[model samples]
Target: MILAATGMRREARIIARAGLVPVISGGDAGRLRGLLTAQAARASAIVSIGIAGALSPELRVGDIVVGDRVLIPPRNGEGDHPQGGGGERATFGGFAGPSTACGGPPPRDKLGEELLTVLPGARRGVACGSDAMVITAAAKARLYEACGGTLPLIIDMESHVAAQVAQEHGLPFAFIRVISDRADQDLPPAVTCGLKADGSMAILPVLAALLRKPAQLPALIRTARDTDRAMRSLLAACDVLARGGVGLADRG
Candidate 1:
C-alpha cells in the first residue's frame, strides 16, 4: 500500500485511493510523525500531497511543485522539535544551518521525477517543512533569502515528517504540492486559526476572528479563492496520477 501524508483532512480525502492510505496531521508535527510511524510498516512508498504556501516569487496559486528534496528544521535534541517561523533563519545540515535534508538524494528514479513526467507543467524544486505556518510575505521572503538557491522553494507542514518516515523505513518517498498562496501574499489571521484538530475548517473560530476584526474578511476571501484554485489543481493532479498509475505500480 502507498502512504499519502497530508496536513489537512480535505487533502487526505483528495488523495484517498484503493491502494493508498491517507494520513492527516491536522497541522501538528508530532501527530504527523506518530501517524507516519504507525503506518510505515504496511506501506510500500510514501507521498506528501497537498496544498502548500509558495516561497518562490515566480510561483503562483495553482502551480504544482514536485519536491526534489525536503528541507526540515534541525532538531535541537530529540523528540518533537518546535516549528520555526519564516523569518527565523536556520540551515539544513548539508545546505546551511536552519534546515536539514531528509531521505538522502531526490527520488528521480522513483515518484518525484515520475510526477513531473505525468504533470508536464509541474516544476521540480525544494520543499521546506515548517512546524508553524509561514503566513507573511516578508516571512516568506526572509526564508527564501536565508535558504538561498536557484531552486524554487515551497513550505508546508507535513512533507518533512513524511520524508523522515520514508527514510526510516527504507521506503521511496515523493512530494507533490500545489501552491495555495503565493510569496507575495500574507495569509489572513482568520485563515490561520481556521483549522480544527481534525484538519477540517473551524467555522466558529473563523467567524469569531472575523467578528473581532472585520478588516480581515477581504484577505480571507482572497485566501479562500486561492485555496479553491489550489484544490482544483490538486484534484487534477490526483486524476493524472490515478490514470498514469503513478503510485500503484510498485507495491514493494
Candidate 2:
C-alpha cells in the first residue's frame, strides 16, 4: 500500500484510481502514528503528495516537486536532512507545529525519481513540507522571515505527520506536491470560506460566500482549471507507476 496523507488529496485520488490502496490522513500526527503502528508490514513504501510552498527562487504555479527535508517548529535541535529534489516546500506564517526533519539522503533515494520517470514532462524540485496552509500575502511575508527568506514556494497542511509515521515504521516514504496558488497570488477568500472543520463542504457558507463575491468567478475558475490540469498530470504519473508494473529495488 502507498500512502498520500503526507499532504496532497490529489495523490490519493490518483493512486486509488490506479489500484494502489491509499490510507488517508491529515495534520493530526497522532492518527498517522496509529495507522503506521497498525499497518507497516504490508506497506512496501509510502508517498505524500499535495500542495506546498516554494523556498527557493525557482518554482511556479502548476509545477510539481518531490523532495523530503521537512523542517517544522516544536524542534529539539536537529540538523536538516538532504533528502530528494523534486518535492514542493512550505511558505507561510508562524510555528504551526513542532519541526521534525524526517527524511535525509539515503544511499539510494530512488523512489521519488523512479516514480517521476513516468511523470514525463512534469517538472521536479525540492518540496518543503510544513504544518500550515499558506494563503495570504502577509502570511507569505512572515514565512519569508521565519525560514530566513528561504521560504517555501507553496504551502499546505499535513506532511510531517506522514513523515513521522514513516520514520517509526521504517518505511520508505516518497513525497510529491503541486503548486496551487503561489505566494504572490491573492486568492479570493472563497477558496477557504466554506471549508468546515472536517474539511467538508458547508452549504450555507458556500452559498452565502458565492452570493457575496460575484467578481470572484474568473479567479475561481482559473484556480479550478489549474488544479484540474495538475491533478490530471499527477494521475497520469500514478497510472504509469502503478499500471506499468514498475518494481524498484530498495537501497540500503
Candidate 3:
C-alpha cells in the first residue's frame, strides 16, 4: 500500500484510493510524524501530495512541483522549531528528526520519477519544509536566498517528515505539490486562521480575522481564487494518478 501524507483533510481525501492510506498533518509536524510512524510499516512506498507555496518567483498558482529533494532549515537551538508547534530538532534516526540541512540533499528515490510519468508537465525541483507558513513575499525571498544554490522551488508543511519516514523504513518516497501562493505574494492574515487540527475549515476564526482587518478582504479574495485554481490542478493530478494506477501498481 502507499502511504500518502498531506497537510490538510481535503488533500487526503483527494488522494484516497484502493491502495493508498491518507494521513493528514493538519499543520502540526509532531502529529504528522506520529501518524507516519504508525502507518509507515504498512506502506510499500510513501508520497507527500498536496498544495504548496511557491518559493520561486517564476512559479505561479496551479504549477505542479515534483520534489527531487526535501530541505530542512538548520536548527538554531533546542527551542527553535518549524513555524508551527512541533519540535523537529535536527537529528538522525526515524521520523522524529530529519537528516538533511538547508542546502543538503537526501538520497534520491524512484517514486518522484514514477509520479512524473503520470503527472504530465510537472516541474521537478527541490522542496523546502517549514513548520509555519511562508506568508509574505519578503519572507519567501529571504528563504529563497538562504538556500543558496540549492534553490528549493516550493515550500510546504509535510514533505520533510514524510521523506524521513520513508527513509527510515527504506521505502521509496515522492513529493508532488501544486502551488497555491506565489513567491511575490503575501498571504492574508485570515489565511492562517482558517484551518483546524482535523484539517477542516473553521469559518468563525477566519471571519473574526477579517473583522479585525477589513482591508485585507481583497487580498483574501485573491488568495481564495488562487487556492481554487490550485485545487483544480490537484484534483486533475489525482485523477491521472488514479487512472494510471501509479501508486497502486507497486505493492513492494
Against the true structure, candidate 3 reaches a TM-score of 0.86
TM-score of each: 0.86, 0.69, 0.86
Predicted candidate 3 versus true structure: per-residue lDDT over 1-252, tens digit per residue: 788889887787887843467889888888999999998887787788899998788898999998546666553222222332233324221222344323333455666777777788898777777877778887777667654424447888888888777777777777889999998898888888788998888889999999999999999999989988998898888888877556556554
Write model 2 residue lDDT over 1-252, tens digit each, in one string: 655563334455676765555555444445555665577667766566655545444566667765553444321111112122223332111223333333433333466566556566555443444434445555554544444444343444555555556665666666667666665665666665544443344558756777897887787787667667667666666666655544632321
Which parts of model 2 have CA positions greater than 4 angstroms off?
6-11, 26-37, 53-57, 73-109, 122-124, 148-153, 193-204, 212-217, 245-252
What 10-residue stretch in candidate 1 is worst by lDDT? Answer: 73-82
Clashes of 3: 1
Question: Which ten residues in a row are the worst by lDDT in model 3?
Answer: 88-97
Comparing 1 and 3 on lDDT, the stronger one: 1
Model 3 deviation from native, Cα RMSD in Å: 4.6
Please provide, for model 1 over 119-227, each residue's C-alpha lDDT reduced to its tens digit, 9 standing for 90 to 100.
8589988887788787888777766765564588898888877877787677778788999999999888777777887888889999999999999999999999999
| Model 2 TM-score on a 0 to 1 scale | 0.69
Clashing pairs for model 1 are 90-97, 90-98, 91-96, 91-97, 91-98, 91-99, 92-99, 92-100
The order of the candidates by TM-score, greatest first, is 1, 3, 2
The predicted structure with the larger TM-score, 1 or 3, is: 1
* Candidate 1 C-alpha error for residue 65, in Å: 0.5
What's the lDDT for all of these models? 0.76, 0.53, 0.75
